[model samples]
Target: MKSNKKFYMVREDMLPNSIVKTAMVKEMLAGGEADSINEAVDRLQMARSTYYKYKDGVFPFFNAENMNIINISLLLRNVSGVLSSVLNCIANLQGNVLTINQNLPLHGVAYVTLSMSMEDILVPVDDILDKLQDIDGVINVELIGKS
Candidate 1:
């Protein structure tokens, strides 16, 4: 089982500006946005103090270190809007979709691969998959990779 405990890790060079930007980018990225804190900070070249000054002001949603992501695969019926429902389900479950790939449906079957991570999902992942499979158009769900 994955730990739900919260912990903070800061490097010697991590300043307040760096921290704030890092936190913001992290939050946005977790919501299916692009570019992590490292990318934004590296792009803006902001100091650590600036980040720290507005850290509490920006977002209060920061939970814990969330780099460990899981990759999943699924088989679904070749029908309209099924993928959207799956994406919505992931969001409702508090899981962030990092990457997605879907193969062309032939003979009414589609293969989907998703990479995601959940910073605060308390529900067991097995239950999550079962719920996804229970979707009207979903045929099967599987966890293919995790790290």
Candidate 2:
């Protein structure tokens, strides 16, 4: 039988102890708390086989190290407050706007490109895009580049 499974983003406190321990063990290994997998599992009182089983299946919601720079292009309606709304959305997500380039409005639409630092963004890029799409006067949004 073939099965399709759905995953969820749940709070840490809601997870089972074993799953939490699996994440802990993975972190310990990544942070060099232990020289080897065996040592890390031993220190955590978890089995090596169990750790390996969940190693690839579990990870933290956000890894700050991966937060870098991203450039996005947007086509917005030529209207007052449209640009402000976009910037405000980024700010609300804690994204730092590095540079903004906007083309003059033509045919009731304006093209905008923004470069931002993602070091402090609370959620993933996809979530940010979804929020931007929810705002009025935003015609379209695309992730042009990321680093």
lDDT of 1 by residue, 6-76 (tens): 75555535545556565656565667564655555455676545655665544434342436577889998
- Among the numbered candidates, top lDDT falls to 2
Model 2 Cα lDDT, one tens digit per residue, 1-147 = 223766579898998877888989878878889888888889889887888888777878865444588999999999999999999999989889989999999999999999898877768899999999889999999999998
For candidate 1, the 10 contiguous residues with the lowest summed lDDT are 57-66
Among all windows of 10 consecutive residues in model 2, the one with the lowest summed lDDT is 1-10
Deviation in angstroms for 76 in model 2? 0.5
Pairs of colliding residues, candidate 2: none
- Give the TM-scores of the predictions, in the order they appear: 0.56, 0.55
Residue pair clashes in candidate 1: 15-48, 16-48, 16-49, 16-51, 16-52, 17-48, 17-49, 17-51
Candidate 1 lDDT: 0.75
Off by over 4 Å in 1: 1-66
